[model samples]
Target: MALTQGIPNNIYGLHSAEEQFREKACSIIDADTGLQLHLAVTEAAMDMADVLRQFDTSDEDLKVAQILGMRTFNAFGASIKLTLSGYHQNSALILRDVMETVFLLDLFAGDRLLIERWRFADKKARMRDFSPVKVREALDARDGFTSKKRFEVYELFSELAGHPNMKSSWMMRPQRDGDAVIGPFMEATALEAVISEMGRLAVQVGEKLDHFFPANWDQCLPSRLAFTQLKLKWIKTFYAPAGGP
Candidate 1:
């Protein structure tokens, strides 16, 4: 396998990354080696999108669930692509949003009245009730600590990339000594674990809507989860149960 060397940036010296891409008509930096390992991860997410788009439902509430499902998976897919595109911070930022929506989806699943509240919430009501902190707190309270430690992961991404602060500067800097540029730079493992969780949660939300749209989900998305577990086992060949990008 050909390994990435030096700064694996899309941007070249006078040519901007966009211009370089336009000239080449495709990515100049080859990521096929890393990409092949993630095909299952991409496919799992894609399958969920397929389910959300085509599944039939008579319930109006389920239709609403479908829309939110689409939003959740669309953002999930965007985060994955952003990571591949070499925008780790931007990817983290988007993944943070995915986590937030997944939490909301879980809450909506249990008591969809909350969804109505959320849908009709004024700006002030939203800030007061549906904020990330409030939402995580609610989930932790409801699930008896399913979200207790998960919130820590959400906080990590939020601090590192979601909000502008001193810590975020590290995102633009290289791991080794060097200058930095507004990136399109490589970070193959930046959010691997969180992204794995995002994939699971995206499908989890889909499962909640299974009552609305009947399909053979157990053998489909759930089985993929069983096999891959989204852990990217390829990194260690044995340490992780599955390969990840």
Candidate 2:
């Protein structure tokens, strides 16, 4: 989670803010906390990597796979880095990429569970903190798709999800896998970044609202959207291969 010093702006921070907006849009409570959701994502990722190595592919493909695998890992790490820096946009973008790319990979059913967990986390945040911010509304949802390759790679996960898992041994129960990834993957620095960013944005938005509007906008926003609805919407809008990064 320790990003190299002098890291730039927060892409993920903005993403997180968007997610909060979505949750507020629907008034849902996510089942997982930020820390818990983060751990679920990391643990599920490791589990997925273990499953992928079992396939016997060509050396060339394997090498490519290895690079992609590392990319997945690094994507998560980048999120942690953003979290530590308290950069909401950067951390949120990383988290969104991880979900759209690696977490959606269909290798392990655990990935599905993890995605649900993230939704749950956002939902929880929305419910606990209902303060609505004065958004620019200038953020074109289109701006999120700057990397076409990243978008294509994430879509592959949806394509793969069509195939069903046939083995019983691969199954994992939620309680049994509880928060295992938090300690290892959600580093202290990462946790600090996420909490700090969320808190900071809340303040910024609150001030903006107070400055522009006559009354509080807190009650108008919902906590979170339905998970399935949010996922499908994100897949269509942000994961377009033409503009994804």
Candidate 3:
């Protein structure tokens, strides 16, 4: 199988050697299987979600859940409809797991079915040509019209903390200025808020998984969800745990 070289300038611009190496490694693996790895990993994640939805999650369910948990933590594609600017550096990693999990659930029917099978093997075409406009139109054309809910937050932390301005606008308050500590203090406070919310979300997620998967809920839920966090690229963005720099 021939692999494409030379990174495009439009998107994925100027990745580091390490990033390129990892992407290439992933590319090579996917090339042989015709991106079936993505589909399989995606399917596995859905199975895991299903297992979570079930009352009696078996050993096989737990195994699949763990694997899916890991995969969901590492597969995502994000686009900015607002602007080309303000793309988070490691945002891809952060949403990888959740996006794959959701995508598999919605796009595929518990099977590795494609919502658009043509996208997988269109050698002469490019995914970039699949415009956002077209996608929006398709969604609009769907029979089930109103009361659709958007997947706003990837995790509980995002729901609580809300999206922050990465470029913090420093306010010049002479009263608060005490040895270049204002920026640090604000950033720290923001971080603290994230951690607090994430902790709460963790508890909620644990309870939900327990409700869904009773058999392996106790045995695998912690490890599975923990793996989800581990594969996440930027934990700091969501809110680093307490005592973090």
Candidate 4:
């Protein structure tokens, strides 16, 4: 008798494993909670776009806002798509980029010097000093806001998800099942956390806008009201303890 007689010679096991992975991915990606989060982010981007359209592109603040809004929106959309496709780690990386954009926007909103520096950067050359940490620190110092904790948390999460270190590799470790090894499944919680953080940041940016440009709110009352209502609905549906059905 041959010693290797017990092994199956067909590719059925591989096919079965692939099917299991697909089913697992679908369950998390198609869940109601995830869908709600995605919708909330989408609505935020739409409202931001509407608000941006009200400002002339030639205005310095509007120019900065446009760049920040476009970059944040693109990163957020990419993150959502990556999460839905079972690329959770890369999604987190994109979410980290979203957070950076938010911090940059906040800094620009508070500091005239930074805004001028950004606006006057060489048109043909890329900005080489747009560090998120530095921007956050400057903004916090200028505004007396304590955002160090949140920035640290975002940095740690991004490193774990985006780096090529052991921590990132270990997250996808396969499970041993006799002679077979099953790969790691998608992590829905990570994507949920990203969405929640992004939502919070968006609300903060909106509040800042209202505080800094009260006249804009009055001028654009109808649009502002619509945006505020959308934000409130999102909070009630996904964040409030007694709200979601």
TM-score of every candidate: 0.66, 0.27, 0.28, 0.66
lDDT-wise, the better of 2 and 3 is 2
User: Where is model 1 more than 4 Å wrong at Cα?
Assistant: 1-39, 176-179, 191-245
Q: Determine the C-alpha RMSD for candidate 4 after optimal superposition of all C-alphas.
A: 8.3
Tens digits of lDDT, candidate 4, 1-245: 45565557545665565466547656764676645654564556546645665665566766667666767667767766565545556667776776776777777666646677777667433235456666666766776777577567666766667677756654343322223223434455554555566566666555444333335356556656665776777677667787536
Model 1, 217: alpha-carbon shift in Å?
10
lDDT of 2 by residue, 34-135 (tens): 434334334344333333444455544343334444555566556545544333334554544444333223221222233233334565563342211101
Off by over 4 Å in 2: 1-34, 47-58, 103-245
Candidate 2 global TM-score = 0.27
RMSD of each: 8.9, 23.7, 15.6, 8.3
Model 2 worst lDDT run, 10 consecutive residues: 131-140
CA lDDT of every candidate: 0.61, 0.35, 0.34, 0.60
Model number with the top lDDT? 1
Q: By TM-score, highest first, what's the ranking?
A: 1, 4, 3, 2
Candidate 4 vs. true structure, TM-score:
0.66
Model 3: pairs clashing at backbone N, Cα or C within 3 Å: 72-97, 73-97, 75-96
